[model samples]
Target: MPIEQGSSGNNNVGIGNSNPNAMLTVGGGAPLFLNQGASSTTPFLAVLNSAYPTDARYGWAFYDNSTNGNLDIFRRNGTSQGIQFMSFNRNTGDVAIGESSPLFLNHGSSNSTPFLAVLNSVNPTDAKYGWAFYDNSTNGNLDIFRRNGTSQGIKLMSFNRNTGDVAIGESTPLYLNHGASNSTPFLAVLNSVNPTDAKYGWAFYDNPINGNLDIFRRNGTSQGIQLMSFDRNSGDVSIGTSNSNGNKLAVRGTIGCEEIVVKSASTWNWPDYVFSKDYKLKSLQEVKEYVEENHHLPEIPSAQEIEKKGFMLAEMNMNLLKKIEELTLYMIDQEKKTEQLKSIILKQNEIILNQSKRLEKLENKL
Candidate 1:
């Protein structure tokens, strides 16, 4: 609660500029605190100025020396001799809030050393507990930081250099280039899963005929490859030229599991899962559940009895043919729509031509 201002031979009771002779000015105006120690130094303000804990055990202070540059903020620990938090480079221009170093800079064990280094940008040291984003102005990129178990993390997606892209690993990483969206693109993606374990995840970039996107993994290395391609005319599945390279190859042999069937273009947004909305069984569990819940159970059949109960091979073949017919019908419907649109356009063109001719005859008669 008590404040002191020192000037030369006398000390002022309340806030005011220190007299030219005072060694220190504790309160506001001009040199907030002018220290006239034989080595007379401009006074600095300590926000938590009390001898013991002020409001709480932690305390902070701010100093303003306009003659040098601008106002500055500083914080201190009860036992420490220097300010633990402050604004201003002791070696550079005067410390000013919103002037030079506007935010609180915590001085670690080293004197005047900044705990966090921000270059040409507004930086949040820590956000959402451990998330931090650095908006670098000089290079024009955003650097996002997240505290992992023993390290800092970042998103390594592609970005635009002209607009500013972020590097995945380092805080001060350079924003190099743009991505598919004509912005900064990422060169790589780092996985969080264990590196050695086959079950752990992996990531890589696939830059085929079109653009680049990261491919992630869960089980096998052979399956990690991604094909960045699409059929332009039919909008069917087609891998890009980059994907055509044997490098993007997936094991073509009969596999243990069924290959994922992409039903529609919009399905890319969701993780690939077995079956679509009309969920038939995706796994054995689903199959059992459906049989138990939907069908009336007769007594458990013996091996010989089961053979008689099961569908005949001919019946299975017919069901398979029916599915093929359904798919064929769907394709034919799409083709029909295409033909219909073309016919409508042609008819409109003929009508326009006939109308033009009629108008020409009327003009001649007039």
Candidate 2:
């Protein structure tokens, strides 16, 4: 090594002349290795400005070998202000861009705007793409916005942490009025495409007509075909239809099943009125006359009426039970009449036997 001593007590080592201000300088460096002590905790390079002697820190880039060999770069704001801007954690494989205490892969930290913004170019002409996470001021929710260009962007999604509701797409989501029960319900996807073309998709809507949470399948543009529905108030489930016409469940296609078991309390009012004291027991003649005149039983709907208004199963069952109870009463009345006639014949037979005995006695005396 060739050495040159300067007037300012500076030492220059190697082939060329050194700058006068530098304390120690190396000339003609193919590669210069400034190796600190072999301690894993110490930094490999520390560039400090000697002008600020009291606040001695400046900037440093180091490889930490103690843990998982992480590379950390730090910058100084002022004489005493040192801030770490970038870190690569080898253990977790996470790179902190503008943050020192990073929790995620690309974390950002600042006092003004703490977010990560990826830019294509510093100039406005190039396309910029980035995503920002922030708190929404209006509703006090967590919002994530995605930017396409520099100026124009849209809010990608938001989450209300308090209510556990998430919203996607445009800021103002579609308001599906689910009455007063559910306040903050989330909608997964709402796609509005061309109306004329047949687009196959499904949607859950609060139907105003039937007052149900209806699941509808969109086949074309002419509204949506109701696939299923649930009565939020009554807890009734309707399949293949909304059951707007008084059916608990309705299916458009034939059902194939191994077994279907129905367990329910019947709502039909049984015909116990026949056993009541106020029940009017009509004569058989009167019942026959009424049936002949009307061509149907009294208080029962005729065939024409059934065809016109359709049949109510519960009402039809109750009517049939009433007829059965009336028939039972008629049978009991006939049984009582037959018992009376048999008693009269027994008395007639006893009288005839006594008259024969008297005739036999008169003949013996003669």
Candidate 3:
């Protein structure tokens, strides 16, 4: 009987073991059996550090909480009992991390670090390939990272807690506030080759300073070159140009559109009002005098004014219509005068014919 228990198992026992410290220690790559007949539901196994925790929290433990019937596999983390990091509810058959009461499968709730990580193949070549998601307690942000994907180091997406901002490829996004002030960006995507180079990226944000929605893209290292912008204050739009010049739309380049619609005022505002009886249709003489003095038609903008302020297309159309209506009225007056002159010419012809007949009768009497 080489197996011996020293006086009712009071002293330490060893099987192929050299340490005399452990009460029951198994060595030589063999399994250590605690008990063969104990209830499996009874939690008893624990692996701990050298010093015992006076608080009775095991450093490495497999135990049932007894309160919620949850079996927890715990490991030490920064001097705290991290049981919920890997816990399974015996009652609900739920596996969770950092969740006190898990209801579904693999439900994880965490604040500072990621609850789960799915790394690339366990091979050595995949060292820098992985994805992680976590809620950052420091900035109250939710961030997702791809180890080495888009442009450079590992920032895929981030959501800010305070500003409702979503940023991709940029950590600290800069935006413009309603008053054209520089606020943090709402959503940005930048993949430029260098930090100082804005040559290859684009951003969408609300400019705090300009109070407009701006779409900015980098082209050959240019910064803040807006591809398009919509003014929040004036409802103006600009393309290839940042300044709308108070116009509804301003384009720095040529535009080719299938159709463009510019709405005018109501029907009553059309130039048909010029034909109304109450309308003062200036005489042709008056118009001639005005054109001679001003070198332009009356009630029409001058060429200098058009060049300076730019004319409205719809307004100009209405003004041209008014001039055409005035011309038509002048033609009507001229036609009436021509009819009167024709009547006078016919009566003169009748008088000449009658006088010639009287002379003929006198000659017959002679």
User: Pick by TM-score: which candidate is best?
Assistant: 3
Model 2 weakest lDDT span, ten residues long: 177-186
In candidate 3, stretches whose alpha carbon ends up further than 4 angstroms from where it belongs are: 1-116, 120-130, 133-155, 158-186, 193-196, 204-214, 229-256, 259-268, 334-366
TM-score order of candidates, top first: 3, 2, 1
Every model: Cα RMSD to truth? 26.5, 13.8, 12.9
Encode model 1's per-residue lDDT on 222-268: one tens digit a residue.
23544333333333333423333323332323346666553434423
Minimal lDDT window, size 10, model 1: 120-129
Q: Relative to the true structure, how large is the alpha-carbon lDDT of every model?
A: 0.39, 0.54, 0.57
Candidate 3: global Cα-lDDT?
0.57
Candidate 2 or 1, higher TM-score = 2
Error of 3 at 291 (Å): 0.9
- lDDT tens per residue, model 3, 1-366: 134343545575555544322354344233232322222232234444422221233455455666656666555442445444455768645454443322123234244234333334221113344555656677777766664522223656666677555555554443322222232233445554122345456656677677788777755454567788889989999999778988888888888989989765565378787778899888888889999999999989999999898787788887888888888888898999999999999999999999999999999999
Write one digit per residue (lDDT tens) for candidate 2, span 1-366: 555555555342323434322333234322121333422333444444431112335544343545545666555544343565556757655455554223224333321122334333222123345655555555766666565764426666666667555656563343222222321122323353221123445556656666787776656443457677788777777787776455666565678999866443477457897899899978899999999999999879999999797676667777888998999999999999999999999999999999999999999999
Best-fitting candidate, measured by lDDT? 3
